[model samples]
Target: MPNNPPIIDVIIPANNEEQSIGHVVREIPGIVRSIVVVNNNSTDTTAEVARQAGAEVVDEPIKGYGRACLRGIAYLLNKETPPGILVFLDGDYSDYPGELEKVVAPIIHQNVDLVIGSRELGIKEPGAMTFPQVFGNWLSTRLMFVFYGVKYSDLGPFRAIKWEKLQILNMVDQNFGWTIEMQIKAAKHGLQYREIPVNYKKRIGTSKVSGTVKGTFMAGYKIILTIFKYL
Candidate 1:
């Protein structure tokens, strides 16, 4: 551990989340050194709203969840003093941004390489997650445990990781497989990881991936394919 407190930065990948991005950005904990919001080719005012909320906004014209996250990483890496820890969170308001401190606690104090915020273990409001979302998480996690021998509860979007370890993962998923890809690679690399409970609520708007049948199917297919692709 460094003599000084480790710097922590947050990355939020947003697409057409103008209505909720500001709240997400503003609710993030004060411990974070910086907040970078990647506007993923949104036709709305997501970028402006995030900037107005005192977050650094970067544009990712190509719309993919992982692509937006990668852009945020690139922005951070270009900095002279990149953060020691990087947190990934959705721009949607479902996640409790204030619990970021709890989410990163293990990495900050216990030398943990990764920390996943497990909504499955948390207090969730009614209708916070759809039936398909719940089922997908269950099946995907079970498959990962069977294949990779790592137990994961939910591939929740809110997560923290050591920046150095994260770069080593060479993350490349451009869409739905981003979170699972990270979890799978962490296990394969033998990184120390933990899941901590984090409360969830209904998002400010409909979920892009789960609100529609087509989106849900495509996301599920991509996640399952990615799981097998790595095997």
Candidate 2:
């Protein structure tokens, strides 16, 4: 491989984010070689808007977060030449696409395998996060430290990981537990990881996972179960 890496493939998992998809797509740094937006069975014009804003759209007719992410990764895996860094971001506009450098810089410039965007470590727009998300992050991170000797805060979707390293992690969480699954597996696999505070704002619409009582409970349950499954 050349000393200067060629490109970075960005995978955005989105569902019904038509209102914000266009802006998010356009905001991704121009240095990104390919932007893949996985429209996970959206009921709106998310795919169309993303395409209009210059993103390669991939259809993932799945409901879970991990399912969509896996589809995106699979696309890159089958490509002629896989990208050096794979960035994962949500389409809900909660994450700042303009800050992509911060999430991927550690991996590209410093040889880190993973970089996570920590929302709790920075300022959050009003209503950007709910009480359950805050508590869940704290409780789950505590559990990771207690059981697996790993530590992370704010399982935010904005993150980046080296392509080959991510493939080796063998991640398998299919739903709300996806973030923690990768984090715990990275710890177990001993990948060089780091976290940086990132700015987050309230999404264009209500969050499917955190806006409802049932969703919140199920997410918490799944996260706990995912951790225990590894232990």
Candidate 3:
């Protein structure tokens, strides 16, 4: 470990996740100094419940995964004391929030700059991932390798990165391509990256992306477009 422990922050982008955001906020490890849950135009009680569960809630009236994430990032940028390491995860309670310790270990102890929590490399509960999600990850990562020359398993949203390196990524995607855009930018900037196994289970509610036909199609299309856009 470093002479002083790293200050950690977590960002969760949620929309109408009133049923699950609280658990995601509460289960995160104590090493985290802040949990910023971005309510992405939620139609329900997500912000209210996230605040009740000890998280700092911010509102992003614009509805997009990347928009919510960027909102949280902007909030952190204005923090009097910024984080040493920043983690991004979903608010659907699909991932085991307690596993954040394992997610950031490489950054904490091994000087790694980025770590992706790969469900493919980890235990994923049955039905946790839809067919399109699995296919999209495979295709997107394959394209990344073919084009960007970086080999990665999945475009996982559950990832940890050094705060400084994250700033260098200059993430700009505002919708479905957010995760892929981050990974691509990280590779372009030559950040040291790793993939660690993480447990995944059924989320508390329907997935906005993989749960709907339009969502799945749009997500897949955007991911492919994002890969080529940066190429």
Candidate 2, residue 15: Cα displacement in angstroms equals 0.9
Off by over 4 Å in 2: 1-3
Please list the C-alpha lDDT of all candidates, in the order they appear.
0.95, 0.89, 0.94
TM-score of each: 0.98, 0.96, 0.98
- For lDDT, candidate 1 versus 2, the one ahead is 1
Tens digit per residue, CA lDDT, model 1, 105-149: 899889999999999999999999999999999999999999999
Worst 10 residues of 3 by lDDT: 1-10
* Predicted candidate 3 versus true structure: per-residue lDDT over 61-135, tens digit per residue: 999999999999999999999999999999999999999999999999899999999999999999999999999
Ordered from best to worst lDDT, the candidate numbers read: 1, 3, 2
Q: What C-alpha lDDT, on a 0 to 100 scale, does residue 153 get in candidate 3?
A: 89
Model 1: CA > 4 A from native = 1-3
Cα lDDT over the full model 3: 0.94
- Which residue pairs show backbone clashes in model 3? none
Candidate 1 global CA lDDT score: 0.95
Residue 111 displacement (Å), model 3: 0.7
